[model samples]
Target: MLHARIVRGAERATSYEVTLWALALVTLALDVVTTTYGLEVGLAEMNPFVNYLLPTLGLAGTFVVLKSFALLVGVAAWWTMPSKVRGVVPLGLALPWGIAAVSNTVLLAGIHL
Candidate 1:
């Protein structure tokens, strides 16, 4: 049997924060490689508008800017939204991040999946 521990202590980063930031980092890595390498096979191409627009600053630059904005927005929402709602917010991020990371890795390896 397992139990959950509730900590009554000083402020600290929650598992949610760590998980999201990690996911974001991985997603950002995948975005950088895919965009820079011109893989053109993953989720990035799904958004044709942003995909076309982002190259103005180069792939890495554009990815950094956009991802930073998203992270800021996510952090703010995570902080202010209700506890119940916070869980959903991270869940929303997980899919896209996971998709980008996994798909980009596969595409980079020349696996057409």
Candidate 2:
């Protein structure tokens, strides 16, 4: 019974981790899409770093580099952190990205209508 309970707990943890990772990926995608659309419509980039890169790397290149860096950081955190605290990595990434996506969508909606 004890062993079965441990397995169940581990499975639950794994599912939770997967859910958080999925949320992070979805939010990242939304953020990229909204930012790309906003830029095409003449909206300014609010992130100073990305804004600086805009001129040099252009749109697709900048997002590729930015997202690649984020992926690396997330992978590193997942490998180095303990299982109990692993959720933080994806949660941290998702929250800000989700917020940006929502705000961008709202601004774009306001502009179009």
Candidate 3:
């Protein structure tokens, strides 16, 4: 018989880490790609309606998708994960990934010319 150890304040941390990490990662990625690549889908021009509009829209859309996925994952993990391992696993995973993703996005966006 396997016993699960529940940690203090793990559930909320898991949820927050999942959601925020996704948000930060996606936001940064979208910003970087759009700012650098300027968004085109196989020759279809994705120019913004106004200056900087396209990047804004792109970032928003990316945020929505990533956040939705994160939320779903968090909920699933919360329910399915063993109490002992629930939050720690995700927090450990999300924190590093989140920082990397955020930094990548910022760097990419910064270099956009």
- The candidate that achieves the highest lDDT relative to the unseen native structure: 2
Write down the lDDT that model 3 would get.
Answer: 0.52
Which segments of candidate 1 are over 4 A away from where they belong? Answer: 1-17, 38-46, 111-113
Give one digit per residue, the lDDT tens place, for model 2 in 1-113. Answer: 99787666655655588797899999999999999999889998989999899899998999999998998999898889767667667877888999999999999999999
Q: How many residue pairs collide in each prediction?
A: 0, 0, 1
The number of clashing residue pairs in model 1 is 0
| lDDT winner, 1 or 2 | 2
Q: What lDDT, from 0 to 1, does candidate 2 have?
A: 0.87
Winning model by TM-score: 2
Check candidate 3 and list the clashing pairs. 5-84
Q: Give stretches of model 3 more than 4 Å off.
A: 1-57, 105-113
Q: Give the candidates in order of TM-score, highest first.
A: 2, 1, 3
Of candidates 3 and 2, the better by TM-score: 2
TM-score of each: 0.59, 0.84, 0.38
Indicate whether candidate 2 or candidate 3 has the larger lDDT.
Answer: 2
lDDT of 1 by residue, 1-113 (tens): 12222231111224365575676667666666665564454434556755676668666566777777777887788789655446444555656776876776676676553
Query: What is the descending lDDT order?
Result: 2, 1, 3
